[model samples]
Target: MNKMHDFEASLQVLRGSETDITSEVNVIKTAVASANKRTAIRFQELNQKKFRMPLILGIGLLVLQQLSGINAILFYAGSIFKTAGLTNSNLAACGVGAIALLATGVTTWLLDRAGRRILLIVTSSSL
Candidate 1:
């Protein structure tokens, strides 16, 4: 895990037009494989004791994140821009994605720092 993180840190340094993508991607693939091995071993160890709760939560999050409506929002992002009162939806969708990304970051950051009630209030007020 530590080595994988270090590899990723180095990979980031190779970004931009000057970087060789094929080699970089190969390195990333190797890092990913290492990470997968570590994850499999960790899970196998945890299976001996108690891994149910966190595993269930992870699977639930995965299912929720990939639900039809979430995919619909991604597929119909252009429509969302128009629905949000933008004239040029193609361009507006990019802005919408940026805003959504920022909102996700902020919400995740506030999840523990701010209570659920206050978080809902802030989100609702923004909407």
Candidate 2:
């Protein structure tokens, strides 16, 4: 209740409120319970036989993505550039960062336009 009062105080700074904060908190609690129930239903549905393949594929792909050396390159970008005889490794690292940002922008654009299946296929194939 003290935390809820603190939260209400924070919001009151931005907006005036005459209503009881406890009532608002009760409404939020009910909404959260409904959301949790829906999520549990979805999890039960996902456990069905029809969803098994997709669940496996999704988990497998996530594991594979971690196994990929993308993180290694990003983590040791300076050392990588140095090993490749680049005098200004920092510039190379910055170039890598810029390219990663551009790729993320392009992927975000393509995901809405081209859809997930195509993007996943293209990205996984490139990997």
Q: lDDT: which candidate is best?
A: 2
lDDT of 1 by residue, 1-127 (tens): 4575666557667575456666766776887778777434464565654677777756865775675366788779998888889889988778778898998998888897977778656644553
Q: Pick the candidate with the highest TM-score.
A: 2
What shift in Å separates residue 46 of candidate 2 from its native position after superposition? 6.1
- The 0-to-1 C-alpha lDDT of every candidate, in the order given, reads 0.72, 0.83
The TM-score of candidate 2 is 0.61
Error of 2 at 117 (Å): 0.6
Total clashing pairs for each candidate? 0, 0
- Candidate 2: regions farther than 4 A off: 1-46, 50-54
Give the per-residue lDDT digits (tens) of candidate 2, residues 59-109.
989888788977888999999999999999999999999999998999899
